[model samples]
Target: MNKAFKYSYVSDFLNLPEPYSEGELQKGLLRQMKDFILELGGDFLFIDQE
Candidate 1:
């Protein structure tokens, strides 16, 4: 049988403080996610502008 998986949007996982610049939030979130995946020993492939 084939297995299916789901992926989450990065924005949804991030809980940023209000009044933050969008650029800043995006950069912070990406860094956070990268660290988390690394810590978990999971592989990550980023596809920007998807």
Candidate 2:
């Protein structure tokens, strides 16, 4: 819709993947936590442990 089209350009530079919450609860929890932190917007950074 045009209502949100004004900001569509923002997505052009931001190529983010969909939220992934699969497997066990602990694995999903980490994904959700990382997703939350990343969604905070503006200069928020985090490191993921493998």
Candidate 3:
């Protein structure tokens, strides 16, 4: 996790606000599903979210 995130992360494109909760982050990502998927590249896929 440390190697992947490198102690920080970015999602300015998603327009998510700062000091957000886990639920808020998840919802914000889901709201921009297409953009997130594209950002993930062609290797990953969005099958389903629970």
Candidate 4:
């Protein structure tokens, strides 16, 4: 059997909602995602837009 563990900070971050319009939220998410990829050594690639 496998046990699950959770981080409170990650939970809190995940629970946050986008504080903007749909398009704005999408833009923000995309920007953050790109930053995340780059921060993780720039080896990630986004293959889809939806």
Pick the TM-score winner: 3
For residues 1-50, write the lDDT of model 2, one tens digit per residue: 58778665332223334542334444655666788889997688768735
lDDT of each: 0.63, 0.57, 0.77, 0.57
lDDT of 4: 0.57
Q: Per-residue lDDT for 1-50 in model 1, tens only? A: 33443553346446666656878677877877766766765466544521
Candidate 4's residue-wise lDDT over 1-50, tens digit each? 33454432232333336454667656666766776776787577765556
How many residue pairs clash in all the candidates, one count each? 0, 0, 0, 0
Arrange candidates by TM-score, descending.
Answer: 3, 4, 1, 2
The worst-scoring run of ten residues by lDDT in candidate 1 lies at 1-10
lDDT of 3 by residue, 1-50 (tens): 55877867787866777878888888877868956786888897777764
- Model 2 misplacement above 4 A: 1-23
Which is the winner by TM-score between candidate 1 and candidate 3?
3
**Model 3: runs farther than 4 Å from truth?**
1-5, 34-49
